[model samples]
Every structure is written in structure tokens, then in C-alpha cells.
Target: MIISVRVQQILLLLTLLVIGISREIIQLELWALPLALLSGLVLQGIGDSKRRRKWNIASVTISCLSLCLLLRTQNPYVLFYAIFFTVLSKFLIVYKGQHFFNPTNFGIVVCLTVFPNLSWVSPGQWGNYFFPSLALSVIGVLVARNAQRLLTAFSFLSFYSLMLLTRYLYLGDPLSIFTHQLKSFSLVIFCFFMITDPRTTPRSFKGQILYTFLIALTGYLLQFHFYIREGLFYALFFICLLNPLINKLFPAKEYQWAKKI
Candidate 1:
């Protein structure tokens, strides 16, 4: 039987989570995962109830998994608050009919900003495990293919790589520095999963290319110029504010989880 894209996403994220746990990449309290998951589901359920819409367990699962992976916090209450706001943001932060900021990114950013001491984003937490990086890349390609957002993913990575290379040449950085930066596990995940998020991206192919390119350029500036640690996330967050105008200029079709591009 053919699997739904939502199911595919759920499976892929779950697989990544398991691998992360096994490799000790995800070091959190035993209760963190369950608490975060429960919070996401319950909040989402309430949101759906108020909106008189059907509950989507897949969305809840995906958001929670993303939180568990990206966010590192010792406080269960902090995780719960983040997940709670994550679900709540979906309902409150609307543009037309869809949410503008990506749910996972928004939640993580908010918590990080508000509770800087208690919460953190472990960009290098995955380390440079070659095998896991390869596996994640393959899975990301598969997911992007099915989602029809492969172009966006490739565009983002290509532009981002070019920026990195340009910086390396200008700074006269060593080849090893370039290699190390390119092999970042967090960068791979961001390219494949977050940037390729169909719902948040522009509809037309040209729009997506331009959009991803802007994100890459801005991210490069933030990272290299200002020395921001979470440059990619912040770049995406700020750029997403202009998505409405981008969609208006290059409108094609809104993405649907049930439909393959």
C-alpha cells in the first residue's frame, strides 16, 4: 500500500529520533519526550476543537519530534511551555488560512529567546557522523521528492554551499575548514527538512528558488558577518515575515499533505 506523505514524514522523523537516541545525540530526561508529546497533542486538540476542525495526530507528532530533536532543556515545564505555544501558534499566527512561521522553528525560537538560560539549541549535537549524515540526506531526498519540494531543498543547499565557498576563498580559510562546515549534520537537516517544508515555501518553482536563495544569502551574512550561532534559523524566521508578499507575486498552488506534487 502506498503511504501518505504525512505518514512518510512521521516515519522519517521517528527514525531520525531513534537514531539520535541510540547515538546519544538526544540527551534529555526520560520524561521530556513523553511530556512534550503530550503537551503538543493536547494543545493541538484544543485548537482543533475551538476551530471546529478535525485533529491531525501527524502534525502533532511531527512538531513534537522536531522539538525533541532541536531543543535541549532540563526543565520539563519549559519543554511543555514551548510545545504548548507551538500548538497555540498554529491557531493564532494565521495568514489567510495557513500559519506563516514554521511550527517547530517558531516554538524553538520563542523558547530560546524567552528562556535563554534554561533552553538552548544544539546545532552540533548530531556531530559529524558520516553514516548518519548520509542516511539523513537520502531520507531527506525521498521526502522532498514525494513532497515536490526537492527543488527548494536543492536550491537552498546549492546557494548556501556557494556562499560558504565564497567565504572560504575570501577569508583564505583552510580546506579543512570548508570541509568541516559542509559536513555539518545540522546544516543537512535544515536543508532537507526545514527549508524544504512545502507548506511554508512559495508555490511556483521560480519563487521557491528565489526564496531559498534569499534565506541562504541572509543566513550567510548573519553567520559570517555577525557571528550568529543560530543564523539559519533566524534568517528563515525573519524572511518568512515576507511570505505573504512572495506568495502574492508568485502564486501557484497551496501545498497539501494528501496531494503529492
Candidate 2:
């Protein structure tokens, strides 16, 4: 039986939440999750009302969960602002009837940039455990497949992995060093959840492939050359600026959640 893409995303993220909490992998406050949900839902409701559209609870929940999972902050106000801007960006940042910035990504980058002392991202929270990484990959593939953006996810992973491998080869590093980098759960989640976001990604398959390739290349340069830890997020933000042009060049039918799979 096929499931809604949003539903699959929620389930996968919830599973990660449980694992992260139970294993004490993530350093999140107990109140963070509820605050994220409440703020996102309330803000999303207001946005929907303004547009005369029904509220999308699933989408809001997914964004809240993503924020809670990736973003870390001790201040409640910082957390609230993150969720506030995350939901607000959906309504404010639009181009050709679609929002290009992934809401969660936007919020994280905004908070990190604006509140550098209070906010940060912990990419190593998920660790490099083989079994957990595999589980995340399997479920992430299912979610991406349901969203009809599996190719986007895989292409990003492939391109990013190739860059890592090339760098290791150029440095005369061991193959294990390259494989060790590939074991990151944060990278997997970025590939499947953030970059493969249907609304933000290009409609055409070719466009998506090209889009992800650029993201991979930009992220590699930022991480390796500039030494930015959150290079993927920055790369996606920069690449999204060119999304409209990519869509124009490789136009296709826009995706709708209500469309039959």
C-alpha cells in the first residue's frame, strides 16, 4: 500500500527522534519538541488563513521535527524564532507560485547566522554507527521514493561521495577515510529530506540531477576549502537562488500533493 509522502516523512522523522532521544545522541531540551510543534502549527495556521487555504498540519509537523532534530539551542526564544521564521518563510519567500527555500533549512541558517552564540547544528549527533546509518538510509530512500524525488536524493549522495573519494585520492589518504566520511547520518538526512524536498527541488529529473550536482560541488568546496561545517545548508541556500532559472531551462509539470501516485 502506498502512503502519502508527508506521512512517510513524519514516520521516518519520528523514528529518528525516538532513536536520538533514547540513545542520548541529541542534546535537546525536553520542551524543544513541543515548542517547535506549537509554534509551527500556529504560524502555519495563520499563513493558511491569510491565503484562504486549509492548514497543512503534516507539512508543519515535518518542519518542526526537522528543526528539533538538527538545531540545538538552550534559549526558548531562539527556538521560537527558529520555528516562527521557518513557517513564515513558506508564505513570504515565493517565486512563480512556489517557495524555493526549504523552510527548515532557511530557519536553521537564519538562526545560526543571526544568533551565532546561541544556536548551532550538531552533525555528529547521529554518529557513525553502521547499523543506524543503514537504517536511516533505508527509511530515507522510502520517504524520498514516496515523494517521487528518489533520483534527486541518490544523485546528491553520488555526487557528494565522488567528491569525497576524489579528495581522499588526491591527498593519498586511505580508502577507509573516504568510507568513514560516507557513514555520516547527517549527510544521509540532508540528501533525502532537505535537498529532495519536492516543492523546493526542480520539477524535471534532469534539472534535479543538475541541481544536486551543483549543491554537492558547492558544499564540497565550502566544507573542504573554506572549512565551513554547515556547508550543505549554505550550498542548498545558494543553489535555491538559481532554482527559478533551472526550472525555466528544464520546465515540467509542477508537483501537487493531491495528485494520484
Candidate 3:
């Protein structure tokens, strides 16, 4: 059976949602994915068209493999559904697939609210998971993948570090926030997964940098105030909220929104 591009996306999304819910990593109970899937069905009627090979391959390669290999997850079911819900939400939310919010992060939020007990694991402790991100960057380049990936990642991470450093100084905590920042699973995952979401993040170099820094700053505040482990997820969502209206004081062409034909 042939699948259309859009249809494939919807299926992939619901599949990942199921995986997340099933893993008990988020708040949703048994029917979490089904709920999201049902919503997609009602809101965006399922379409039938032949799936594009390259797009499917890319989605499967990154989203699927990342779920399985790169992330330091104990859940076996994370990779069960052969789909990517994060990107699927992107298609639904934005026009022409240009987004400033990471779909994966958004999904994490949904999972968090729906299933608070469900955890999004950290991988900074894992050595193997660390360096593969470098590989993904190269692969992203080889496939002509998201261009502003590093810019977005560095901006978010660096600023997030600064926020922590500030808070640690204010709190008089003797522990090194720098090492803590490096060891955080949230930081690792955001740099690799959420910050790199092509649709939600800006395409231009300067824009991505600004967008990333915004996430880091907000995440720091949330963690300091509320102590949310998945503060990065909420931070990314806030940044996405900001990106639509964000205007740079200093103008650069790379920071401009993607041109949609």
C-alpha cells in the first residue's frame, strides 16, 4: 500500500506518541497515542498518497534510530511504532513546514502533561550516546539536512549554562554548575533532538542562535523556580511561542524566516 507524504507523517506521529505513552515515560496512560491519533483523525482527516522515499528514509533514520540508539532510554517500546510524531505535529501546526518550535519537544510536553510520571531520560552520563551527535551533524550535512542546527544547539546550551551559573552563584551552591550542565540529560537531549528540529527552529544562522539561547535562558528559570527536570522541553515550547513574534535588534539575512514557495 502506498502512502501519501502527509499521511505518512500523521501515522508516524501517532506511532511515536504510542511509543512514548507505552514506555511510561510521559503522563499518558495506555490510550495516550490513541488519543493523539484520534485527535489527528478528527482534526486532520487521514489522507492517502504515496509516501516519498527520501522523506520517509530521513524520518526513519533520524527519528526512529535516535529513539532507539542515540537516546539513553531504558524503554524498549520507544522504537516500536515506525513513525515520528514530533515532525508530524509540525506539519499540522505551521504552514509550509517552516516552524520555530521543535515538534519533538512539543510532544514531550504533551507526554509530560498527559503522563507526568512518564520520564524523558537523560544521556549525558552515557559515553556512547554522546559522540553520535557529532555523527548526526555530519549526516545532517551530508543529506543537506537542517543547516542552522549547530547554531541553534550552541545558543540554547550556552545560554542555559549561563542561567544555571547565575542561579548557582545566587544560591551559594559550592558545586560546579558547569560540570552539572555538562552532565545534564536535558542539555544533551535538547542539543541533539529538540534544538535541531528543522521545522520549528529558524533556518538562518543568527536566527537559530537567538532561538536556541532563548530556550536555554527560559529553561534555566523554570528549573530554578520549579525544578522541572524536563524544563528544557517547556523552555523550547516557550521559545517556539517567542519565535513567531521574535524580532532581532540586530538584523541579519541568515536570521530571516525560511522562504516558502
* C-alpha RMSD of each candidate structure in angstroms: 1.5, 1.4, 8.4
TM-score, every prediction: 0.95, 0.96, 0.58
In model 1, the worst 10-residue window by lDDT is: 141-150
Off by over 4 Å in 1: none
**Which clashing pairs does model 1 show?**
none
Q: Flag the better candidate by TM-score, 1 or 3.
A: 1
lDDT of 1 at 6: 69
Q: Local distance difference test, per candidate?
A: 0.84, 0.88, 0.50
Q: Write the per-residue lDDT of candidate 3 for residues 1-261, one digit (tens) a residue.
A: 844333433454354445444654333434434433333333222321222222333333334323332222233233222123554554556643344445555555655565444335453333333344455434333322334655566566667767777767788886654555556443554565556655556655666677777777777767667877667668877778766554344334433324321
Ranking by lDDT: 2, 1, 3
Native-vs-model 1 lDDT?
Answer: 0.84
Q: Among all windows of ten consecutive residues in candidate 2, which has the lowest summed lDDT? A: 141-150
Q: Is candidate 1 or candidate 2 better by TM-score?
A: 2
Report the number of the highest-TM-score candidate: 2
Candidate 3: where is the Cα deviation over 4 Å? 1-55, 67-87, 96-100, 117-147, 175-177, 247-261
TM-score ranking, high to low = 2, 1, 3
